[model samples]
Target: MMSTPVANHEAIEKVRDLIQGIDNAMLTTMTSQGLVSRPMKTQEVEFDGDLWFLTKKDTNKYQEMLKHPAVNVAYVGKSYVSIRGEAELLQDPSKVKEFWNAAYEKLLEVPYDDPSLILIKIKAETAEYWETGNKTKMVKTLFERLTGKESEETDLNKTVDLD
Candidate 1:
């Protein structure tokens, strides 16, 4: 239940550290059929209340963003993080070039100047993360669960307000 307020710098910095090296995030978007998730490569830029991803307008995710802007981004690496936010489609060419790399160029098979290429800017509202690196905490949690008693020390789970 520990939630970091928006004004705290530690909250945002911790979130950035957690998701720093994650290659891809599962972006969950709402659609008429319900929620759909897809693996999307996040931009290398540090998290500063916003997350960016490169996508093409021809994709279903882009269309879904048009219908519903709410989305969730999940990252699993050293820790598990869940980011809730609203999405905005952008055609900022300069930004595309900034994050673009040879790998992207090879995979997309098109230059960064392609008309369909677009950026998805996620205005993150909150980030919830769980650190699984502590084995002692995990065992204690399991014991507590078995005995139906809560521990004084809480799990290494926190919610950071990004907005």
Candidate 2:
């Protein structure tokens, strides 16, 4: 018997792990003029199957998302993850509470209970990730070889698709 490949599940988990290490992501969206990218803070909640963010409903980013739901979130740390998804503005209190934290109160001009506060829910449909070796490690290995010293080989580059 053969088993079906669980690519989606495995990929999601990998992306989630990367998110844990990096709390910042660049959210790219299309405007009537052109593409715009904004640095957004990731929610404190876990990245289960979706990515969460808080923004103001009246902001340019929110307006852009409303006009074009298609979006891409890029996160870089030990690896790089590019997630493609459709964004939806959420206003539910329960959901807001789920992702809300006291730290966010100072970040936003409006209160958490403010109706203008919108939650951006990204339903990721696909993702791509690239893992590269640390900068210091790579440089050190190159220097060792140049100095006639033996250096251990390592496989550093890896690509993964989550779709």
What are the lDDT figures for the candidates, one per model? 0.89, 0.80
Clashes of 1: 0
RMSD of each: 2.8, 5.0
Q: Candidate 1: where is the Cα deviation over 4 Å?
A: 1-6, 139-153
Top-scoring candidate (TM-score): 1
Candidate 1 TM-score over all chains jointly: 0.87
Residues 33-150 of candidate 1 have per-residue lDDT tens digits of: 9999999998889888799999889989999999999999999998989999999999999989999998888877789888889999999888998887986786788799779998
Per-residue lDDT of model 2, residues 1-105, tens digit only: 222358667777777887676879999999988999989988877776688999887789999998899999999887777888899998887777677777778
- Top candidate when judged by lDDT against the true structure: 1
Error of 2 at 44 (Å): 2.2
Clashing pairs in 1: none
Positional deviation of residue 87's Cα in model 1 after best superposition, in angstroms: 0.6
For model 1, what is the error of residue 75's alpha carbon versus the real structure, in angstroms, after optimal superposition? Answer: 0.9
Decoy 2 TM-score against native: 0.78
